[model samples]
Target: MKNQVTTIYKQAERFAEITKSAIVSGNIVRAKKCLALAERLFATGSYETKNAISNVYVFSVSTFMELRHCNISNLFPQSLKAEYLKQINTSGV
Candidate 1:
């Protein structure tokens, strides 16, 4: 469990970095892909690791959306977010 948590945390960190770059480069597709992967990985981490990664993911994406004059809340529709989380966690993709 400890090793898995550490591994997931590190992978999520790298994904968050790529996500930030994608956001800056205007590569929304890549950003979303990485974010989705991170979300999937979020399923297996320890509670603290999950919260840290969640903060990074939310802040990175929300900031990008804010800069684009988008409503941060629109980043993910509540229903869609729930559905995707369910699907990704189950699919283990």
Candidate 2:
């Protein structure tokens, strides 16, 4: 179980890296695949392992949102929505 969790963690990290790279390279489809893989690994891993890997998921999602021209802060609504709206206005997308 320990080894499995370790492997999942490492793979999740790699997936997270791949996701970021894919987004930066404008390969959103590949980035989505990587994010899905990372999420699966996180779900299968132990609690502590998943906890450690959570940031990888967060970063992956952030990259995806950025690629989509959305702000992470806006995802929560409230005042953050204004921030995202500003970005949208300035980006002209």
TM-score of each: 0.52, 0.48
Query: Please, what are the lDDT tens digits per residue for candidate 1 over residues 14-93?
Result: 65677778877978788667666666556666787666566555555555566778543444535335543543366544
Model 2 ranges with Cα > 4 A deviation: 1-14, 60-93
Report the C-alpha displacement of residue 61, candidate 2, in angstroms. 5.0
**What lDDT score belongs to each candidate, Candidate 1 first?**
0.59, 0.56
**Clashing pairs for predicted structure model 1, backbone only:** none
User: How many pairs of residues collide in model 2?
Assistant: 0
In Å, residue 76's CA in model 1 sits off its true spot by: 4.2
| Alpha-carbon deviation at 35 in model 2, angstroms | 0.7
Residue 42, model 1: lDDT of: 61
The residue pairs found clashing in candidate 2 are none
